[model samples]
Target chain A: MIILDRRQIEDLIYLPAAATAIRDAFCSTSRGEVNLPPVGHITFPQVSGDCHIKYGHMQGKPDFVIKIATGFPQNAETEGGTGNGMSLVLSATTGAVQAILHDEMVMTDMRTGLAGSIATQALARSDSRTVLIVGTGPQAMRQIESHAAVMGDHLNFEVWGRSASKAAQLADKLGGRFAVRSVSDLETAVRSADVIVTATGSTKPLFQSDWVSAGTHITAVGADAPGKQELDVNLVARADLRVVDLAAQCLDHGEMSHAAVQGLIAGQDVLELGQVLLQAATGRKSPGHITIADLTGIAAQDIAIADVVLKAYRAKGGRDV
Target chain B: MIILDRRQIEDLIYLPAAATAIRDAFCSTSRGEVNLPPVGHITFPQVSGDCHIKYGHMQGKPDFVIKIATGFPQNAETEGGTGNGMSLVLSATTGAVQAILHDEMVMTDMRTGLAGSIATQALARSDSRTVLIVGTGPQAMRQIESHAAVMGDHLNFEVWGRSASKAAQLADKLGGRFAVRSVSDLETAVRSADVIVTATGSTKPLFQSDWVSAGTHITAVGADAPGKQELDVNLVARADLRVVDLAAQCLDHGEMSHAAVQGLIAGQDVLELGQVLLQAATGRKSPGHITIADLTGIAAQDIAIADVVLKAYRAKGGRDV
Candidate 1:
């Protein structure tokens, strides 16, 4: 069997193609065409782990996808860091060992980035030119990449990080394409940007309802684990349109969890990203509407990305790709 | 991140010492001192998967063991056979990455053989010399190797397989010290042998009640998966002592599942092998008593064997040893 190490996987696999496939996979899964199993887990002491498998068609693509993922506490004692995750892929039409990937953190970032980009593509105003991103980690960088990929030359970017140096470094990395700022000036960045992305690991909310301007789109990707919040409950409640990757996971562990706990949004109030992507439901109704998309990540994305990785590997003569 | 291919893993690992160490680990885990979590899974027409994290002390060993295992069925499609099964092991005290093993089937065979040898040592009469093995696959060979390792000079072997060639081949290979015989006559093999090992992949019972004579000690390892049976219900009902690897798992999927359903053995009738090993329960009572050990593979065995493999790997400087 062909084995791809971390470096090869990161360099050879195209994230843009993976993102597109994952978006389509999510849409197809929501239309009752996918075989997605309920996640199960055993948790105790300092460790918790979960597994899920999903199989589905992607629009005109008739292939099936399946993935398994596990999460350990970042502080847990393991040779690899606790958040390390891996996925194995197989072809649905012909059973073949497609690919094995060590993209635990990368998978999380890319999928969340795709979710944000998809939401922005559908919901953000076409004329939207300025973007504000909160957080300066790899995930924040991916959000910028995804936004630039999808929005093309229509947007300028501003970034705010807890550490000013990190934010400036990211801004410099972006070159003249965007302007990056520090958390001290986050208010100015948020007020002027037409779209905002929050990608922090904060356990408390970073954005207040009063900080947001009218007709702005917000994508929150950081509050994935339980008790990890990145947006104010009031901000979520006040959004004219709010979408989530998976309604159940979002309500239980994403930005919507706190809002649901406070009765700001009932279970049925949340709309799925797939529903919006397929045009079965409306996204941004008006240019003046406040939109929020909460991305908690999902197995469908991993399965989709795995499919792409496998195909890419096969196309490259099934080795080192 | 040492990745060993199938051949490398097979060539470098020593099973005899690993088997012994695994047996000790299981004994230590049985005394209510393990730190493992319960295994969980979701199975449906669309998807099938399980995730588990387990840790516990083997009944008689000082070191505790832990493992995380997860798999998705769709993975098999990509691999061109069965989906991949992967597990990570950690040292309980130091919490270091001891080893990572792939292919659960191989791990299962090794650990089950170790368990069988451990039970044979504690339950079989010291004078018991002849072994009747019921299958001729890798598991059967492993059982023979483990039994020979522990029992040493006190063992002679007779093997029966559906394929006469395989049985004869095994007999020829092992005949030098053990007076090996290939028996098409399964009845005579069972009746005359002191220790009977049933390792076939039969859905129906392979042995009848009349075939088992008094004082025969049967180690049935084939009835691990659901719907698999190796011994008639009557034989199960009539055995004087029925020992099981895990009473709960046995009741659900092991040989005891059929017996329990047929009302041949109550759930409480069988004793756990761990309990017997720790003297919390009894095993063979008299030389003339009929005894049976139902060997259903368990996660405990995985944890135990992983601990052994990790120790050996480290002691040998982490190379294939």
Candidate 2:
């Protein structure tokens, strides 16, 4: 099997290529052309660490992908930080492993960042300018970069977090590419931003529904597991257009689960991003309507991006070129 | 991270050492000291293939293991035979992957074989002489070798399968070690053998209940998934001692599932092998009693054998020795 390290993965990865693959993956997911099994998870309370195994196969594809991603919050204090992951691509015909991409969580962040950007571009107003990013972490930076890759760098960006200095550091780190700053007033920033992206690992809602305006768009990516929430339930229920990566996943553990449990919405109330990408379902009914895109990660996205990386690696004369 | 291929893994593995680790793992499993999540599976109908992901962490252990094992029956026609698998070991404290053992299903077969032998040694009558293995797969040979590992090579061995030539081939392959021969009369073989091991991928009972006599110890390792059975429901219900790897997994997918589903037995009717190993439960209540061990396989066994392989790799000055 081909073994590609993190550096090799970064050198081979192209965000635009990943964006296209993810777009196709989103569409395939909604068309029910992907076989996504339930995720396998192992949590270690001693170190506040957890690992997730997600695997899937797209119909008629020559390959399938299995992804292993891990997080250890305490590792940041002692080790370099704890976003580690790898993807295994295997042949659909022979059931033999074809490649091992040890991307060290780079692919995960890129795919997630691309998903957030795709949702924002699809749901946000055409005239939108300012983008607010919550949480000062690796993903926050990725969200900024991916948004630039897809939507250009003309828009202003604001970073907010519970740690003011960290937020300032994050903004300062990314200020070279785009107009960005750290904001202390969350409510004011939430109300003024054209698009808001929440990426913090928070159980409680980050902001109130009343703070968001009518013409704003929100991309929530924090609540990927059970008991995790990012957007307020009222805001989720109040959104005019509620779009999800997958409706069943969102209703089970994503940002929409809280509102769904409270009887605020039904399954039909939300539309899959794939459906919108396929133009089978409408997105952003009007500029004045509030749009919310719940971004819970899925295996189809991993398979798509892994396929992209494999193709790029092979085309570089690695194998089966 | 260290990546050990099939050859290196084969050189590092010792069956006695693996058996000890598997023993500890079984005890830990029954003691509720392991974190075994639900399995993740994906099916590829186009190729008649399926892949299963099993992951777990033993309490207080330094590392956790995630195993990916796949089977493609169609591949045997063009390529080699079907079994393929690998294990990933990661630090529990930091969630960083430490080692990847590309054993290519060797570890899986060994662990399973050791479990069967361990169960047989623990429950079989001390004076038992004849052994019958009903399969012509890789696991069948592993069972023979493992049985000899735990019980010595003095016993007689017989191989039975649907295809007479395949059975003879399997028997001939292992004739160098013990006295082994292919048997066409399965009923007479079942009635005569003191120990029987079934390791086929069958969906129906291989032998009737009446074929099995008293003072027999049967280890059923074939039915590890739903809709697969090797023993008749009557045989499972009639066994004086029905031992399982894990109660929940056995009732859900093992040979015992059929009996439980048909209301022939309940959860309380069976005992965990760990419980029997720990002497917390009885095994082989009487010399004339029939004992059956239902081995559906467990994540704990994977963790155990993977731990063994990693330690051996490191001890040879590979890493952190």
Candidate 3:
């Protein structure tokens, strides 16, 4: 068995490969040939721990991936503690325990970021240049990195955080690659940017419907837990194209929850990310259309990244038996 | 994080103190306060891999354990290959990824054996001496070790396996202390044994109804997966005391599946192992009564053992940050 620490996994597996694999898996899953099961998870409000276990085979792939991830209240940095650990188990067709990945938190961040990038790649217009990133944590940084990687070469980036100092620090870290600037005004950033990414841990909507402009792409990466909202229901209702990782999950817990509660977007109106990836339908048909991609994360992404990590370990002469 | 190899975990962590902790955790879980979620597992009948992802917390425990175990068909001969590879992620109440255990297979074996030992201690009479072990696999060996350790003093042991060499090998290895003998006839071993254990991977019953003697205590540990049976339905029907790890799981998948299907025993007749352990009711009231413990391994056991392993690692100077 191969055991990989965070650093080892990061160094060996790149985000581009992982993202591509995830995109492929998502498309395959939509085709109904992939054996991905409905996720089984439990939220223990009393103890403050929630876990999701997901497993399945990617169509035409030789191996299967099982991901077990848990988030505990005690591990929140804001709660004066480190966050809970996450891990993935990758096994092959021959039943060998190929790799045990120890960098679950990083994996989660990267895969989640890639989901946003994939959505933007499909939904955002090619000429879209200015991007607004709300939140200045690790997840926000990863979103910036992934968007830059997928969009490529020419785009202006703006950052906003609850703390001005943190926003300034994030702007400095961007290193003038895309006219990085700190926006003291949230509305100004939301109105001007061609694309917006929200990575906050807010329990209420941070963006209002009036702040959003026409012809902008929005990626909502936070609001994973119940009662957590980052975008107003009106904003969600106004979007011409709304895509989700899993429609059922999003309606239950994603930004779509608010829209669903308001009866703005019915169950049938929400399109799955897989459908968009497979090109079975259009994502952004017009240049002036408002598109929103609500990502609550998916297990297929975990499995895809795990497969990449396992392959990298094998290439580096990792032990087999 | 602390990552222990199989041998290191075995040598440094296994102890009576750990066993006691696990037992206590198991007992507390039966009180209905802890929420142990159902495990997510996949079976590859097309190939031969069996993968399981289990997560839960013991009652009053500070950490949650999530274990991923996979059995490889190709490496079944290695020390731990027949069983799946197990990894434990310890998420403490402080919300830190406190530790990562890499040798969960060994810990699982120890904990599973302890479950049987704990059941026998609570259910079997003090005079029960002769032991019969069916299916001479690693699990059978551990069952023998645990039973001998818990039962103490003089005990006669007989082993039966499909392969005569395997049975003889186990007998030779454990012969000195327990007066171990290899028996060609399974019926003879079952009839003579006061305490019988069935740990085979067979899909059909290994022990017949006529084979069991009165007052015998049987621990069936191998019928964990669906359609895996180790004792005849009639034998279960005649059991005076029927104790199970989890009645729902046993009725759906374990040795009790056949009995329940044949209408031999009602679902309500199966007693939870914790209920029996707490002595809410008698296990074996009369000297001539027959008893059976159907152990379909539970997620709570994984949580219990993970607690013990993490504690042992910390006590031995292991660190996680």
TM-score: which candidate is best? 2
Which of the predicted structures, 2 or 3, would earn the higher TM-score when compared with the native?
2
Cα lDDT tens digits for candidate 1, B1-321: 444433434444576777666665555556654533443332222444333333443333433333333334445332112323444543333333334465444555667677888788778877899988998776787788888876785688889998989899878877775667888998888889899988876789887899888888989997755667998889999989988877777888788899899898998899878788778787788998888888866667776666555565567787632
Model 2 alpha-carbon drift over 4 Å, by segment: A77-81, B77-80
lDDT of 2 by residue, B143-235 (tens): 998998888978888999999998998888789877899999999999999999999988999999999999999999988777789999999
Selected candidate, larger DockQ, 1 vs 3: 3
RMSD of 3: 3.4
Q: If ranked by TM-score, best first, what sequence of candidates would result?
A: 2, 3, 1
What is candidate 1's CA lDDT for residue B268? 84
What is the TM-score (0 to 1) of candidate 2? 0.97
Show where candidate 3 strays beyond 4 Å.
A13-17, A32-34, A37-56, A59-63, A66-89, A94-96, A234-238, A257-267, A309-321, B13-15, B261-267, B310-321
Position A300, candidate 3: lDDT: 73
Model 2's C-alpha root-mean-square deviation from the true structure amounts to: 1.7
All-Cα superposition RMSD per candidate: 5.7, 1.7, 3.4
Write down the DockQ of candidate 3.
Answer: 0.36
TM-score of each: 0.77, 0.97, 0.89
